[model samples]
Target: MVTLGQLTKKVEFLEKRVKQIMKMLQMVPIVAPWEWES
Candidate 1:
C-alpha cells in the first residue's frame, strides 16, 4: 500500500540516480575522447 507522496518520493529518487548516471556517462566520453575521435 504505497501512498501517493511515497510514490512521488521514490520517483524523485530514481530521477536523481538517473541524472547522476548520466553525468557519469558524460564524463567517460570526455575522459576518453579518443574513442569518438575516429
Candidate 2:
C-alpha cells in the first residue's frame, strides 16, 4: 500500500521532471503540441 509520504514524494519528483522538460523545450522553441493538434 502506498503511504501519504510516498505519494507526496512521487508527485514532487514528477513536478521536477516536468520543469526540466519545459526548460528543454523552451531552449528548442518548437510550436506548442496542443496548437499543432488543433
Candidate 3:
C-alpha cells in the first residue's frame, strides 16, 4: 500500500537526481561521430 505522499517524494528525488546528471553531462565535451571516423 503505497501512499500518495511517499510516491510524490520519490518522484521529486528522482527529478533532482536527473537534473544533477544533466548538469554533469553538460560540463563534458561531446565529440561528433564524424570526427571519430576520420
User: Residues 1-38, candidate 3, lDDT per residue (tens digit)?
Assistant: 99999999999999999999999989998788889887
Predicted candidate 2 versus true structure: per-residue lDDT over 1-38, tens digit per residue? 99999999999999999999999988996987788978
Write one digit per residue (lDDT tens) for candidate 1, span 1-38: 99999999999999999999999988884655577666
Q: On TM-score, who's better, 1 or 3?
A: 3
User: Which portions of model 3 miss their true places by more than 4 Å?
Assistant: 32-38
lDDT, each prediction: 0.90, 0.94, 0.95
* TM-score for each candidate, following the candidate numbering: 0.73, 0.76, 0.76
lDDT of 2: 0.94
Which stretches of model 2 miss by more than 4 angstroms?
Answer: 32-38
**Looking at candidate 2, what is the lDDT of residue 9?**
100
Clashes of each: 0, 0, 0
Residue 34 in candidate 1, Cα distance off native in Å: 16
